[model samples]
Target: AYDGGSPTRSSQMRLDIVILDINDHAPVFNQSRYQALISESLLPGASVLQVYATDADQGPNGDVRYEINRRQSDPEGYFTINAQSGLIQINKPLDYETRKVHELVVQAKDGAEQPEVGTAFVSIQVRDSNDNQPSMTIIFLSEDGAPRVSEGANPGQYVARISVSDP
Candidate 1:
């Protein structure tokens, strides 16, 4: 036991680590609030409208999945969404008298282990279709004033008839 004891030294080392961003995220629908006008009397297989979105991620991770979350808004599933194309179509005709614009929320998330989510809003404007006929409402004119004539009328017509079109 005549040998001297050895001393130990303490030092610190640096390490380099990098985290690559993945495009595993699904495409997020910017239009969370979407409004589409579907004709109640539309022919089957008619194209209603198309939806759009973008993803922050790239590659397969960026590949998005689309679905209509109208579980609450449309209990019977009146709409359809294209997963790969992001197109929204009408599965069934929509009655403007019953419902004019549909309100829905679309969600987008990354495919990463810890995913990220984003959202957007949309407003769909439905145009009227000449499906429903307009009911005539005759009004007796008083001596106060004459019927308001249209400046761009067809020679003899008084004014444009008030006929609410359908969608």
Candidate 2:
């Protein structure tokens, strides 16, 4: 550079710049916790619910995949998740008598080499259905081996013992 009235001089230089995409953002779930109620008779492979997550990064760093966190939830392998859609499905039969409620920890991870993950708590309440048949047992209270009631039996008189259970 030179003053306007004196002399002119110039210098030339080459400059190089590069922009890189980095995994700087972790996946974030739309909700911290989700709740759902489903009938115990719901068949396997049926959709339970869908979880959502997003990342602020670009490209692969923002592509999120879903999974059931086995270490934290679903030890019995009762549920499965779609990596692309975050749709959760029943992997096994649900029985309200066996398990009334199920708590799961769902995780979403970015496509980065060292993915940043986010976790969401999912509580599923299994509603009891009439899946089980009612069972009954009868015991005779008379001296004979058969259940019998006398015509003169008064109210609340013990005639036979009956037990019924539905589970």
Candidate 3:
């Protein structure tokens, strides 16, 4: 059985090798939907929340980078993401009266070439911020010439009317 006998009784030699996994896995978010509450008056660079994702692939395939998916629905550019850290930060001030809740689509991509992408929804509720100051105006009844308050002005008599408004 010198040949075509599967090397029996010859100096039988076999080698064992491990085939590593390829970079075929996509990044997966810890949660399908993430909720966060942030003050509307936060600074532009303020950190809102940190997003986390994991990949089953090994080596560079497991490394993830984050990004905000901007589209027609997301007209307001009020958020930014740190690619390396997956940290979401405020890009601008939020107005509760104008828009209360903001929905952002975040994508996580592996470091591999032609990396696979994963999407996650991050709902950010803009909390009320006491950043507005009330504006008021006081109007005193004036005569034809001007307002002249006498020293004996009656307390019950109407002196002035105040109006308040806020923007």
Best by TM-score: 2
Clashes of each: 17, 0, 0
Compared with the true structure, the alpha-carbon lDDT of candidate 2 equals 0.93
- The ten-residue window of minimal lDDT in model 1 covers 158-167
| Local distance difference test, each candidate | 0.59, 0.93, 0.85
Enumerate residue pairs that collide in model 2.
none
Q: RMSD, each candidate, Å?
A: 10.9, 3.1, 4.2
By summed lDDT, the worst window of 10 consecutive residues in model 3 runs over 1-10
Question: What's the distance in Å from true for residue 45, model 2?
Answer: 1.4
Candidate 3 ranges with C-alpha deviation above 4 Å: 1-8, 14-16, 72-76, 137-163
Residue ranges of candidate 2 with Cα displaced over 4 Å: 1-6, 11-16, 143-156
Q: What's the lDDT of the predicted structure labeled candidate 1? A: 0.59
Query: lDDT per residue, candidate 1, 1-167, as tens digits?
Result: 22343565555668899777665555666555566655567754666666677777765556556655564445666666676666766677766666666665555555556656565443444555666766665442334445655466568553433444333
Query: Could you tell which candidate, 2 or 3, scores higher by TM-score?
Result: 2
The TM-score, computed over Cα atoms with residue i paired to residue i, of candidate 1 is 0.52
Misplaced by over 4 Å in model 1 are 1-38, 113-115, 133-167
